[model samples]
Target: PSEYFKGMLSRVGYAIFFIPFFITYVGHGFFSPGWLLCPGFYLLFLIGLSLPTALLNKKLVGTSLVFTGLLSGVIVFYQVNKLSWLSWHKPQRQILQIIEDVGTSQTKTLQIFDCMAAEKNATSIYRVVGYSSSIQEIFWLNHKVLPEIQILPCSEAGRSVASLTPNIIKLRWSFPEFTVLTH
Candidate 1:
């Protein structure tokens, strides 16, 4: 790359590094997996910039190789076992399983109370950017169209359930815990 091109790339790298901060200021403070791409690009930029210097010293080359190998190993391990380590994934999966178990042909709609509230209070890392609704997160995770699921506030649960038909299933959600209500 020419000097101008290298300078432009460096500037781009700095811009990429500050993306999360800009996003946080402009939008909801939710960090999603897509934000990771920025850091990945910055890492590549750094590695590319340092490659020439690293190649000049045999010891530095060896150290860089070792570090790269270690980083690769850690990344592979995380990818392989991410489901177990990601705290929110298990509960989300379990919630889906529960819904699957209880859902049937006769079930027309599924209503979850306090879901939005729970999501707002949640400290989960796996949040969908720009949405504070667990319903969106669930949809993103499953990538499937769920039954007509409505998220209602806890205060409206009684009123909503009272007006519900027999075909609708009501569920009370308090973060990791779920209660299926039988009418």
Candidate 2:
């Protein structure tokens, strides 16, 4: 079990070393609720795989620390300098494209998420996708500007539900025609 623990730690030690985690979550607006669980199971799996080989040689034990340390240093370097390789230009273009695709300049009912984990957030306007139970249920929301809204069950409820932690508002799959606001 000791070797298993160390081996698992070693793999995490490497992933922690790589992955520009800060950029993906904060800058790009990415969110997955159970993301932390991925590593927990992966840790167990790594132990099962690595222990056999590590037990045969004592040197792999030392290697884990070295890999961990080396990656840590690199990650810190990128963060401190504010040097992210992601293209900021790409997202702006995408947002414009979405607007063009949605058409009619609808009054987007924007929802806010606690993306920064901060209190007292502000409202962000979004093109209304319509009131639905899920992603596919786009009916009145499609054509209407600021159409009738539905509070998703799995999401935060009530009016302030928009200010909680979600990027896209779930619309009902059965919705049909919608109104658009004139500029």
Candidate 3:
């Protein structure tokens, strides 16, 4: 009877650990974001740590973890670009073109009207290399008080998105905040 409780706990622990990749994968499938679904990413970190020996390496657990983590990191980085860790898809290329034109030092602010809103205020879409909050902050400091949000494609840094997504990013600013929104 005592062993049953221990077994249940072990299963729970394993589930909690694998939650991240599952969440990220699940999150990709949904539209409206919720708190319940957000924590899956943290589970991925645990999953990265807990992979079985035969899958990665049996002899050296440390080496397996390090190697798997590096690989997973690379894969995540690639997924953000497009969705796949490997291929250079068209959307990825298109986004890369936009990023290159904008350059690392410069930001190309393009006004964007929200697709999913009763009334989405116009927001500027800053085309840069990748996603960064610092870049958005600078835009806000220099510019007018419009509802501002960063637009980062998985393809921003040449990582191609696997699917043709509708709205990749969740909106950061509410429509009422600014008549003009930076997308």
Candidate 4:
């Protein structure tokens, strides 16, 4: 058992460096549930797999190590700078614009609902809100208490929910794909 463990570690030992990030990401999720599938987790997994393959090939280990180091450095720099390449994508930008129009305050909590609930492993709307605002807390309306603000996809159901909801003033933003409801 000890030999087998050692053999396994010898090939993929570099993965140990990613454990802390994975733990931090998981911890963050508990406080702010978001993307069901984290890209960072998969990136680490691929790096681990590549590490072992590079080691087995012998000729690639040094080059792979250098490339990995550069990649990690770039990622660290981007994170430290608070740059988000993925956040600016079209769908994300649309959602973010709606979140921005809803506005936020340090003390308020926001809740969002959408077709995301229909997907098996849906990304939490809170995550999208978090990226665009400084609101302290956000939740999904999926089996949770209704919050002051609700966001839904621009659908008939969304319009009906907005119209039926009390104490909410529907915002007049033309988000061709989403609806914003607020108090």
Candidate 5:
């Protein structure tokens, strides 16, 4: 292949490689592991389609191999950073410690409101994702399961607090902000 053709091909390859990353960022406003599914499949399809052309030209094959290596490196780097960030489950651990300190026997019911809200809002990228049972699962994993623990949304916290029994301990926690109230 001519030098000009090779240069143009390399530039096009680079552009194609970054298309998925750009799409993911635009769609989610950040890069999320979950959001990569569609883009990943699209990239795979493109690769499959390019296989015939790559096999026909030795230079194209070599260029593709280099591009694949670069792609792998970028993926590995992103995953490592994401894993490190996700490992910081400080709020979960702190909540578990508080529960342990209170002694599960003394507290009949535990209510957690605004859970992880502060963290979710503060994070610029990869916001904390959770379901209704996330707190329960976290507590269960820590082996400090409470007999009755209610994970309430911030909106329902006031109503929940009003209906709280004398035996229930209300924990209004929004990650960095934690308050324990005994009724």
Candidate 6:
């Protein structure tokens, strides 16, 4: 009973110490969901270590773990490489490129606004596109608020939205079902 109690205490202590270190190492600087999934690797390592290699064939255990690790690495590499193949399917990248081209052609600073509810994603998207825009849902040019290009859903533009504000100069571009408006 004392031996079991001691084992339990040691396990609790190890858990308290190891979990934080493992989390920090896997997460590095940010708590990525992909990083969180990395603990599965540790599970494999534990299983490999706990398999009684002395009772079972040591050669088999070592070879299987080595092969599993290599296969895991190859799978990760393939998945990462597959993202490039999927890049063209992302419409946000297309919109970003269009904004850049239009801004350069017209010699206007690329400033954009999207749905107010998506403000956080919009800001991150702008950051990724290498442009900055102020937040204002009302598509109006205010010298004090800074001139901005408004990015609206196609549905919003089709409703003859110009009637909402009389003096607004809204230049809109429609691509397939998606559209953006610049004012």
Every model's TM-score: 0.51, 0.27, 0.26, 0.34, 0.44, 0.35
Estimate candidate 3's alpha-carbon lDDT, on a 0 to 1 scale: 0.37
C-alpha positional error of residue 65 in candidate 6 after TM-score superposition, expressed in Å: 7.2
Residue 82's lDDT within candidate 2 is 41
- Runs off by more than 4 Å, candidate 2: 26-45, 53-178
- Flag the better candidate by TM-score, 1 or 3: 1
Cand. 3 TM to true fold = 0.26
Q: How well does model 5 score by local distance difference test? A: 0.57
Q: Which is the better candidate, 1 or 2, if ranked by TM-score?
A: 1
Candidate rank order under TM-score? 1, 5, 6, 4, 2, 3
* Model 6 poorest 10 in a row by lDDT: 134-143
List candidate 1 stretches off by more than 4 Å.
Answer: 1-29, 33-37, 53-85, 115-147, 161-165
11-37 in candidate 2: lDDT tens per residue? 665565325643355553322322333
Off by over 4 Å in 3: 1-11, 14-59, 83-183
Candidate 5 C-alpha lDDT tens digits along 1-183: 364355444445545666665654674454455455445545555554445564546677668756875775578568647545454476556665765566445556667676544446443211432433665555455556645667676787788777867767777765443577553
Q: After superposition, how far is residue 127 of candidate 3 from its true place, in Å?
A: 13
The runs of at least 3 residues in candidate 4 whose Cα sits more than 4 Å from the true structure, single-residue gaps closed, are 1-16, 27-88, 99-111, 124-147, 150-177, 180-183
Give the alpha carbon lDDT tens digit for every residue of 1-183 in model 1.
Answer: 365346545565456556664565465564344345445556555655545553536676468656765775566556434523355555566566765565355665667776545435533322411122555455445545445667667787888767868878787765445677753
The lDDT for every candidate, in the order shown, is: 0.56, 0.37, 0.37, 0.44, 0.57, 0.42
Q: What lDDT score goes with residue 103 in model 4?
A: 29
How does residue 6 of candidate 1 score in lDDT?
67
Clash counts for the predictions, in order: 0, 17, 20, 0, 0, 1
Q: State how far residue 103 of model 5 sits from its true place (Å).
A: 0.8
User: Residue 114 CA error for candidate 3 (Å)?
Assistant: 9.0
Preferred candidate (TM-score higher): 2 or 6: 6
Poorest 10 consecutive residues of model 4 by lDDT? 134-143
Residue 132's C-alpha lDDT in candidate 6? 33
> After aligning candidate 1 to the native by TM-score, how far in Å is the CA of 47 from where it should be?
3.3
